[model samples]
Target: MEAMVNNICDIVLKRLYMPRVGILWTSGNHDFLRWAPSGELTWVHYLSGDFTKSSNHANNPCYIVESLTDPYREAKTLSALIIPNISLDFVSKLCLGLPFTAAGSLVFGCLDEQLPVIVDDTCITRWLRTIDPKRIDEITSRLCNLGFIVISKIGSTSSSCVLELDEKGWISWCEIADRLSGIGVVILKNGSRLTDEAEDRLRSLGIKIER
Candidate 1:
């Protein structure tokens, strides 16, 4: 009730010439900061509003498809589908010319899982330039199943990135080390220390850690 009253009061003040000022009201402080359909991702947001049904928009549709009732929604599409939960700030940066494919990977692959993830959009921009549209649809659908929301681009897209190994990446390194057992092992971690799992795997293979 207080929120409603504040919203009404804000509207009245705006009509009284608040001048170049506006605000968003959500249930929480984080939500208030996140909703930015106002000016962020101008084209993408507009297309979603213009395309999605009024009813669906009211409910904050989870998947803003090109057509809600199409039989082959998985095949072709007009605009990149978006999930409404993404921060408006993120959408704004994306619409400002980030690699759509890499952004898809970053948000769905790393960010959605709350994993410690980093990205270099510049590298992805060059590495993946001509991905098949069907591949994108496949990736998008899979990511969605994993509780991720994506904005997909049609036609060819490009993205590739490689991040430095971090403490969190050790488990993956261990898995790799396990596979290298038959091929003989040479540990080459410079200043970085091995993850416990990595050390265990190498030791199991009778390899000794100098460090």
Candidate 2:
């Protein structure tokens, strides 16, 4: 069965061969500093002529693909994918003036258990901070399953949100309260409050919520 599947895939690939696109994920910090793709590649040349001279006028620029004679020649490079939590500010710099298109996904805290999650035009973004339609649509399906409220921020369509966390496990008791006074198995819930001595002991230990 596996051999048959492999053979079928090979046949299909041979019939419709597509260039394997490579993606270098950028860490948002890289936006501050980074160079161009290093490989056996020539400078972008437009068929009409070099558009580098005309800055004020809008020109349709295209790159002339150059063949690499030495495949092993190294052009020290790095991936562009980055962490949103830390690198929110430099997104623009990393994506601006680059040759490639940008796209991204978002995950977040959800609210409804049944619906579980919601993707809107609020959170995600591309390297260039433009909306990417395909990415947004793909994120929608993933969020519904994963339960994250998300959005996008990149492309022609503009940026949009994607997914978020579900509503079930919101918060825990230990999160809000400052301290745990005692470990009594059973006690009157409201009637029994933290005693003065216990509060003092907790305070000494640097606990905020004594009782």
Candidate 3:
């Protein structure tokens, strides 16, 4: 996992160039992402002590930095790299001795669905509009083969969801169902099909299904 984290940091460093970047993470869950300005990878760091301090408080506070409306926009405007859904422990490891970087509060649960998030155990995902889609597919495929179930949207505007099934199949769905709660759509891909039982289950929870 450490090796994967290092490789992901290397990818971000090679692809982005910016003065500062924001790493956003939620408490308890520890899911995190790198927020960058202009959707490009570059130099990044936390802009304030708010996020680091939030880790100690039960209720996370909000603040304004870099003249933005709020911390989220500031991070978005200044962040140059993103790695999503990683553990807080890895966040520390990723920032150790790194120049111009800081971890901050996400201020909300989950990333903006529009971003192409890499959902995995290590939170390594593709970023930047200029990044090759084929390369993203390659990484997604490799992770799937290794028994990691990936769930992401089909496109930025689409209401549908895409489920990248792991090698062990749908057995893991129950484990991840809570994460899918309140989600409104699901779209199966790569010859994957949801069993009628599963479909009914999702619908019972108010999730819509699309072929």
lDDT of all the models against the reference? 0.33, 0.27, 0.39
Each candidate's TM vs. the true structure? 0.18, 0.17, 0.28
* Steric clash count of candidate 3: 19
Q: What order do you get sorting by lDDT, best first?
A: 3, 1, 2
| lDDT tens digits, residue span 1-211, model 1 | 9999999998666544421111111111223223444322212211222324422222122233223343132212212222333333443444443425323433333333333111212222222345443543343344434433232221222221111233332344423421231122334443556667666644643444552
| Total colliding residue pairs, candidate 1 | 3
TM-score of candidate 2 versus the correct structure, residues matched by position: 0.17
Prediction 1 global C-alpha lDDT: 0.33
Backbone clashes in each candidate structure, one number apiece? 3, 41, 19
Return the lDDT, model 3, position 39.
37
Error of 2 at 95 (Å): 23
lDDT of 2 by residue, 151-209 (tens): 23333232221111122333233221221212112122333444455444334333344
User: Stretches of candidate 2 above 4 Å error?
Assistant: 1-124, 127-132, 153-211
- How well does candidate 2 score on lDDT at residue 74? 13
Relative to the true structure, candidate 2 has a C-alpha RMSD (angstroms) of 20.9
| Model 3 CA deviation exceeding 4 Å by range | 1-55, 59-129, 153-207
Best by lDDT: 3
For residue 205, give model 1's deviation from the true position in Å.
1.7
- Candidate 2 worst ten-residue window by lDDT: 106-115
